[model samples]
Structures are given as C-alpha cells and as structure tokens.
Target: MEPPSITSHLAPSGEVRDIEKAAHTAAPISDPSVHVPTDTVNDDGLPPLDTSPRGWLAVVGGFACLFVSFGWMTCIGVFQAYYGSHQLSNYSASTVGWIPSTESFLLFLGVPIFGGLFARLGPTVILIIGTILHVGGLLGVASCHTYGQIFATQSVVSAIGTGAIFVAGTTAVGTWFHARRGLALGIVSAGSALGALIGTAVIPVLFDRIGFPWTMRAVALTYFVLLIVAIATTTRRPLPADHPHNPFRISHLAPVSLLGHSPVLILAIACFFYFLGVFIPYNYIVVEAEDAGDGVRSSNNLLVILSATSTVGRVMPGWLGDRYGRFNVTIGFTAFSVVLVLGVWIAAPWRTGRIAFAALYGFGSGTFVSMVPTLIAQVCPDMSKLGLYLGAVYIVIAPSVLIAQPIGGVLVSAGDENSRDRYVWLKVFSALAMTVGVMGFVAARASYQSRVGKGKVV
Candidate 1:
C-alpha cells in the first residue's frame, strides 16, 4: 500500500491545504531565503556591527590604499596628455593609449587571486606584498625615459602592483562591516577623489617645476608611507572554519555557478557596458582639449574641478543608498550620467562645456563606484562569500575597462579639427553604452521582482 496522505479529509473544500501547514502547528516552517547576517553569529560576526575603533581604522586604511592605487588611476588623463607631448610622442594616440588602458585593466584583473589570498592569509601579508610592488613599480618609473621603458614600468609593473593594493583596500573593508557597509565604502571611496585631485592638481605643477624623474620619486615616496598605514590598519575578521570563504578554497574562487543567478548575470553584463566608455571624460577630456587649436592647456585645471565634485558624489550617494534602495539610487545616478554625456558634453562651447561636464559628470559617475560593492552584496546571502562576489563582478568588467579606453583614444583620432568639432563620436559612444547599461539594470530589477514579488525596486 502507498503511504497515507499527510493531508486529512476535510469537511469543506476550502479547508483542504498543504500538509506542511498542518505540520506548522508543531514546528514553524523555515524560510531558506531568510539569511541571518554574519553579524548575528560570533566568528564571522563583523565585530559586533563594526562600531568599534578597529572597524573605523580599517575604513581609514582602505581610504589610504585606494588613494594610492585606484584613486591615483583617475589622474591617468594627465599622463595621457603628457605622453602625447613628451617621451611617448612618437606613438599613435591609440598605441600610446594602451598604457593607461592596460593599467586600468590590471587594477581590476587581479581581484580574484587577491580576494582569495585576502580571505586566506588576512590583510597583512598580501598588503605588505602589494606595498612592495606598488612602491617599487612607481620608483622604477622615475628612471624610465624611453617608450618601452615607461610602458614597462608604469603600465605593466606599477599597474600590477596597484591591482593588488586595490583588492586589499576594497575587500578589507568588505570583511570589516555589514549593516553600515554602504556608508563605510562611500567614505573609503572619497579617498579616490582626494587622490585624483592631488594627482591632477599636484602632478602637473610637479611636472612643470621638477620634471618627470623627481616628480615620480616624490609620488613613490608618498605612496610608500601611506601604504604602510594601510598594511597596519586594514583588518579582516575571521570566517568560521566551515565557511566556504574562510580559507577561500582556491577551487571555488570565481565560482561559475554564480552566473546561474539571473540577477548577477544581467547586472554583470550591464556593468560591462556601463564601464565601456564611462572613463572617456576622465581619460580624454584633457587629451581632446589639448589637441584643439584653442589653448588646450587652459583646460587642464578642469580635472581638478571634476575631482572636487567627484568627492561629493562618492560620499553622499553611498549614504543615500543605505537609506534608499541601492539599485534605485544607482539607476538614477547612471541615467543622469547618460543625460550628462549626451546633453551637456556634446553641446556646450569649448571651455564652458568642459567645465560644466567635468563638474556634473564627476559627481554623477562617482556613485557607480561606491554603490557597486553594495549591489554585489545582495547577490550572495553569506557575507563570508563577499570576496567571491567582488571577484566575479570585477573579472567580468575588467576586459571591457581594458578595451574601452584604447577605443576612446582611437575615437579621438577620428574627430575633425577644421570643422571646430572633435570628440563627437566619442561623446555618442559613451552615452549609448550608458543607455544600454541603464536598460540592463532595469531588466535585472524586473527579474529580481519576478522572483521575489517585490513592491520596491530594491
């Protein structure tokens, strides 16, 4: 005979129900989707909501690390401008552009390895190694004068070093806090803007007064001292022995199974498109202005202005995202970026246009950086697996970041000067890429809603 049905014969058709509901009277049904944050538990724990001094210090260390690594990357426009006028003047724009392009790629490229090591070995050992490479690479650039020499030291060597630092800076912060993560990351990301401002404002002045060799030496020395702070302060809370992320089993790094999550796959593709041309304003604003018959040199200060606004962008939006939905705020900011690129960037007169776009776009684009980590947090329930999620996102976006920049350089070459027009194609390309990214975000949210039956976009 078959096993008796868990259900009972009911007096009315309406009384018939799931046997699980009948069992619920004895034991409540458990919801698998309800994730208890690591904060509730001790080992993973996030140090009791991360209000402690050590947690804040980790935030400080993350700021310093990013200031020296990724934040410093924002100033790559100055290098692009300088190379065109100086040592690498012989190379074509697209060819010369490969240096910063590759450097940007390398910064994100090492995340999976670095994230794994960070979870396994803790922040100290990996940070020390990153410090050596980053410091050594910058100092090496001081002696390099030829095309091959600069590319080797700055692009390949220093870039790989910064890549390591970027991972340590971001993931260290990730492991430290849970509830306040968006606010903490936003504060840390402001360091990027501060570094960009210093790099844009200070690097040019240093170049004018001291020349390249000594200028490089000064930057290297500064980075070494700051990196020391990061190594000392950034701390990772231990994950439980059984946690998949505790020792970060290399076998599970960048798990291919994550793509099975509909939201993650859609969002990753969206971010790739978003990043595709987003840096055009940062990397080529100075380059484009410099090529103009009108004094391009006058517009160099715009980068500083952009960085200043970027500081506001990074700090404020992150806090807002915590209060509001991360996805909602991010989508709004991204849409604004599309409007800024298409409307303000392409239409304005030379100097006025550059200034308006720089200030507005800087703030608009800055939110994307700060909010991304928070967005990724939603994809994985376990805070212990944060490193893996971060690695997956970056690895997906890295190749696009690598290629988009060189493509921007090529677009600059395609513009026409005699018509008093340039950067037209570049402007349209950037706007279109952002448009698709916004569409993807919308679709991703729709998918999330379909699965969860959400009322809000979050």
Candidate 2:
C-alpha cells in the first residue's frame, strides 16, 4: 500500500486523513515513533481536585485568622503613633519607632519557616496555638510599662503569632482556590487593609474615650472572638498522604529560583524601594499633621483617613489586576505613587499639601500591596510553594521595613534638632525611593515580557 499523498488529505471528506497528515508533518520535528502526551492529557494528570466541604471550611477559617493577624499588624502604625507621644516620648523617635517596624518585619519574615512547620503539622493545630500566642501578646502589651517591655511582648512575641497565622492562613487560601486564585487571594489579603482601617479608626477613638489599656483590652477581646471562629473553621484539604514535606528543602532554601530569575528579582528590589519610600507617609502622617498645626485629635483622624483610603486602594487594584494583568497594574500604580510623592507631596507648602499627600500616597501604596502577591502568583506555577516564596521575599525586604522609619527619623532629627523639618526630608526621600521603585518595576516587567515571548510558562 502506497503512503497517502499530502494533497489527498486536503479534501473535505478526508478529515481523519488530514489529521494524520498534520501529525506526520510535525513528527519529523521530534521522534516519529515516540508517543507524545497531548496537552489536555498532561493537564488531566495534575494533582487531584479538592472537592471536600472541609477544604472550603478550612479556607474560610484561614481567612478569619488572617483578618485578625493582619488587622493587628496594620494597627501597629496606630500603636507606634500613640506610644511615640504617650509612653515612649522620652526615647528618641528613632529608637521608639523601630519597635513597630521590627514587629512588622518579624511578622512577615517568620512566615516561611512557620509555613513549613504548618505543612508538617496540621494548620488547625498551628492556628490554635497561634491564637493563644496572639491574644497573650496583646494582653502583655496592654500591661507594658516601658518601650523595651512593649518591644519584647508586642514586637517579638506577637510577631511570632502573626507569622504563624499568616503562613497557615495564606497556605489555606492557596489550597482552596485554583481557578479563582487571584480574586480569592485578593479578598483574603484585603483583610489586612480592612483591619488597618478599622483598627486605626476604632483604636484611637477608644483611646480618647476609654484609655490606652482599655483600648488594647478591647482589641484583645475582638481577637479572641475571631481566633475562635478561625479555629473552628480552618482545615487542610485531603491530599495524597505524602507526609507533608517542608516546602523548602535545604537545596531549595538557597533563595527561590524566582529571585535568581531576573523578573522576580527585580520585583523584589522594587518591593524594597517601594516599602522604604511608601512607609514614610504611613509612619509620619500623624506626626506631619501635628507639625502642620493640627492637634493630636486631627492627626489621628488623618491616619484614619489614610487607612480608609487605603482600604479602597487595596480592593480596587485587585479587581483591576484580574483584567489588566497584575504586572501592568502594579507598575502603573507604582509610577502614580512616584508622581504623587514628588508633585503633590513635595511641592505642597501648607496643610492642604500634606493632607493631599496622605490621601494620594495612601491610595497608591495600598494598590501596590494589593497587587504584589497576585504578581507573585502569576510568576510562580506551583501553588503549594506560594507561602515559601512569599516568606522568602519578606525575609529579604524585612530589613527595608526595619530601617525605613528609623532612617526617616534620623533624617528628621538631623535636619532640625527640634524635629521641625523632619516632614520635609521625609517627603523628599519618599519621592526619591518611589522613583527608584518604579524603575525597578519597569525592569521586572520587561524581563517578564521577555520570558513570556520565549514560551517559558509563566
């Protein structure tokens, strides 16, 4: 039997023959006799689907844990402002300011190590322990008499709980959503922003009416309730019994490949600069208002406004990210931040300028935070490794968060011994840092686009 002619397969009646011919034409590009798996078949063979109600329960539970943990972390800015004036005024701004930043760093950086632990132990077990630690840390803070004591209890111990909750909660979310991953993760992450808004507005008002101790006690009570809900609902989905291995092996611990990959590396650098600059506004807004002749009450209200604006910033960008591409959205907002910092913030001479800066920078930076993890998700293929990767990134940037406030404080202290010109220097440096961050984001985006063109899977 003669082999079929290529043109013979072109007839409308020769559908099967045409498929055979097309297959034959492509065969010579590879091994002709070897059977290659179809893309659909390969995808079908992926890890089994999660269908259990328990899996979803775990997801909601995890979100609750996140709401509490991130809420408190975001509220640290409020606490920093409060303690700076009340209990820690005797200490230099640099010294007292380091406490909350350090707490945030530890809270974020400790996640991967704990995430690995959570992977090994059940999330439920980890979350329950974390809840106790979280409440206890806050209670300890309510009882603190000195800056050092507050640092120990609130910064170090509470940070440990925050880390535990973050890793577990984020991993839980990762486990639950695949197709709707970006939207689901966005909603969960929004909890932190919501917490910030609620905490800043509520805590300050509570302090005004009830006193700091009672304010903290109320926060502790709220956390206690949320943690209970978390424990009751949180669980891990059933997967093949592969004795939960640490997501990071010693080999894998050398820094994620994404860091080595130029795109993710640049993004990390951008994050560092973004954090360094953006936090200037967050840390100094209260102080700025006070310097601008606003009273403590008005300063606290500005912080509340920033927090509320940021809550909207966080959610809106996340929704836009789903449509416009995470990288594009991140870069756009980052650039907007740079402009707002320099133009509206640096050039404004009066209270109006300061207030405008707060609103604009608050919204811009909030959008940046909302989009970062989504961008990370786009670059990372394995959902199981999300926590590890995020943790690693935080570990790298932890120093930036640690130093930004103190550095800004030092700048302020140096410019005017009385701290009169600190806000000006803060505005300047913030603008510069954001400019660098935007450049880094642009480089990362270009790198990402290049990789996409190569047909390397995102």
Give the top-scoring candidate (lDDT): 1
Quantify all predictions' global Cα lDDT against the true fold. Answer: 0.75, 0.68
lDDT of model 2 at residue 299? Answer: 77
In candidate 1, which residue ranges exceed 4 Å CA deviation? 1-46, 240-254, 293-297, 451-453
Per-residue lDDT over 344-381 for candidate 2, one digit per residue giving the tens place of the 0 to 100 score: 76677457777777777768878887667666655543
For residues 364-387, could you state the per-residue lDDT of candidate 1 as single tens digits? 999987777767765544445566
Q: After superposition, how far is residue 388 of candidate 1 from its true place, in Å?
A: 1.2
Model 1 lowest lDDT segment of ten: 23-32
Quote model 1's TM-score: 0.88
In model 2, residue pairs whose N, Cα or C atoms come closer than 3 Å (at least 3 residues apart or on different chains), thus clashing, are 58-235
